[model samples]
Target: MSVPETPSTSRYEISENPEGGITLNIHGNMGAANAGQMIDELTALLSDYSPSSLTVDLEKVDYLDDFGTLVLAHLRKLVTNGGNGFYVINSSDKIKELLSILHFDSLDEKMSIEKKRSSGIFIRIGEATLQHISDLKYAISFIGSIILSLVHICLHPRSLRTDDTIRYMQRVGVDGLPIVALISFLMGLIMAFMSSVQLEQFGANIYVASLVSLAMTRELGPIMTAIIVAGRSGSAFAAEIGTMKISEEVDALFTMGFNPVMFLVVPKLVAAAVMVPILTLFSDLFAIMGGLVVGVFMLDLTAGAYMSQTIKTLELFDVFWGVLKGGVFGVLITWIGCFRGFQVRGGAASVGQATTSAVVSSIFLIIMCDSVFSVILRYWG
Candidate 1:
């Protein structure tokens, strides 16, 4: 093949081959004379295509001195700084040898990149998991303290902080009513509507009331309310407690001989235990009411008939089961929230992260616990 010789010594011919990207078939020795010139020319070539990546082939080149190395490194930096990608292929033996010496060989470089990326992901996930478990552990410890305090209070009823506990009850229970009402009512309405649509086709539309009431009262109402509370109150409690923890207020409480569990945690737990059942009752009532509305509108069934059907299908066990589930959910929400709060030991961001983790972790545990309860009851019954 005839060599296509160019007039300009500084600038080299660049053929964009579809088979390979940026094939730079080097002819002569790459040195000081060629280096600066190539850099200027290559810089211009880069401004045009702006490819996702650039591949510089050195297979045709007979030799590459140190100056050539400088140019290649500079090119790489340029592409990266311009927010474009870069790659190298068809390295000559000399280039490969130099790369090996400089610790930039392809095999090692690729392996290093992979290791860094994988380790980063693994580290992030591991950190999240550890943090969650740590928060859970703190929550369990707090509960243990609360249990001890409760035993103490039981023994010395006169020393009980009745007034503070009462106030906590008001906050956790009464204040949470509106949100619980709306969500539970909506869930019931949705269940009723969907059930009525299908059951009406089978001429079983009257059964919609039973379906809505039984499902909500037995399973959905308490679980949904608990999950919501975990999201709302659990996070708030964590943040509040976390802030106090990071600020060393918890230490101060200990120094002053006041039990942090009694001062902060027990109130929330007791309040939640009481409030959850109340909310569950409200949820069951709202859901039934919602089903009743659907009955009147869609099924043309009288409220009396719908209520009668619901009563016939509903069992006392179902009501007790729902309340029991709500109690478990309540314990979970309070435990998770208080635990997350006590686990806080950093800045505001840490508190925020702990709060979010508490909510997510609490919800997961509640569902799992509820599922376990259901399975056991089914087998027991």
Candidate 2:
């Protein structure tokens, strides 16, 4: 079987060799524009004749770019995989040099992944351990920087950016009030209703106020506000700074001789620390009101009695302790959010990952810190 010769205008010629193989005589200027046509013609001839072996002659291919090289490389793979011998002959130094640069001749075999590999349990554990250690070191370093910035501001009040701090305070605190109040109120109502059912069986329904008051002021109010802020403000911080980092704005700050920590992070930190406590106080008040609603309606307690019981049950220390927890949690949330943001190294997808990490880390740290406070207060109080 034989193939027709190429016309004068054609850049490639196909012919059949009597020795049971086909020869492709490629000519000048193979590039992106004509590479597709070359491949199609070669494919058609290969399919019609079904050559046992194929050889591509490239002596006349004066200029070969990456695209043309890639097309030819694919042809080689197709011939070899179909149980036929494939050979390239008569190439100049320029073509060879370009092929070598791209490693086009061996691209498929190098890139082929026949099967996915899974790591052993121990190997995965080791990798995870190392990653966490690196992350922990980063977190510590970030915390140190924040503390240093705070100290510097304290020593030189004029250096602090008060305007940014106030803006963030309004955003992180005032903007978040509605949701915080709603969640806290619902939490208190549920707690009171659940406890009232049990307390009523014991004919101690009035103690419902005591339970709601103590739980909200000592634990729920601070923790709920912190979690809300983590989801709201912490994630926002990470996303904002991560976007700036990816867009090279953070680098521009460095070029302008601005400390990013002092300029960007300190205001957020101060605002969060200052406002979280105030939000917690609001949360506590709203939660108590929710419990009062339950006590008056569900528990059949008079309004005055519920108020009297709540007041007697809650101590100044309990309220102050919750507010203190709020302040500490505020620091954790803001620091983790900013730290994750600064850790962003790549493009838009990295910013997304950093935002998620910030929210998750802040929530985790808040719960852990609350646990520690619970343990210490158990012993101290």
Candidate 3:
């Protein structure tokens, strides 16, 4: 079988061999100019022809280049893919040298691509277990490092980054104030309106103020403020540190004999711990004002009556307890945020994952800690 010759390129003549295989005899130049056309014609001809073995006879009077080598590689792949043997023979020393330089034999090995198989459920579970264990170990270490950093800061107050702390305070507390106040006020209004509906039936409408004030001061105020801060400031801390981590800035800090935790984490921690409690106080105030609005308008109670009831119901201990919870939640948020940031690996995608993880972990910790506090407070009372 003869392939129709193209002008100024190689052509192939396939001849039956004594071994019941086939020999492809090529003639003319086999360079880039002819490579594309040569491969197409060869592929079309060989599509219908399969043999036990195929031999490429390249003894033709011509030159060969990388593109020509690629054509031969393609033919080898086609034959081998059909579970047939492919061989190259009768090349000049120059052609042989070029083939050797290109490591043409490696092409056959490369042609067989290996596919990855998915692991079984047990294997996946085991991998996840190991990963979690590693993460937990890292978390413990990070916590210890943070404690040490705090101690160092206590010893050398001058080392604290006052400017960064103040900036974070503005970001975490002041910037967050409007939204926190709005949410708290709405929460209080809803609570008062709902409670008044039940209390009005029994002539106990004034007790609505007591419910709003006590709930806001003792529970809702600190928890709600912490959640808002987690969504805003916690994610910001993670993203900032994650970016720095991926950019090698964290490593640079270590190389310069600076503790990354002290330099980066401590300021944010201080800012959050100080400001979140203050924010909680504001949240409680707004929530009471919202309740007062509901009481005066909906319940037909005077502002003085509402305020007097609220003050009578809330104790100094209740306010202090909420502020203390706020401070604890702030520390948890900053810790988790910075921890997730330090855990980031790879690139921009890892930073995004870290940011998301930080917010979720912070919120979970906040709720868990709040539950523990509830148990403690219940028993203490």
Best by lDDT: 3
Give the TM-score comparing model 1 with the true structure, all chains together.
Answer: 0.65
lDDT of every model, 2 decimals = 0.78, 0.89, 0.92
Summed backbone clashes in each candidate are 0, 0, 0
Model 2, TM vs. native:
0.74
lDDT by residue (tens digit), candidate 1, 118-206: 45888989999998797567656767788898888789776566777687677767788888888888887899899877897899988
User: 306-364 in candidate 3: lDDT tens per residue?
Assistant: 99988899899999999999999999999999999999999999999999999999999
* Cα error of candidate 3 at position 38, Å: 14
**Which one is best on TM-score?**
3
lDDT (C-alpha) at residue 212 in model 1:
94
Off by over 4 Å in 1: 1-140
Rank list by TM-score: 3, 2, 1
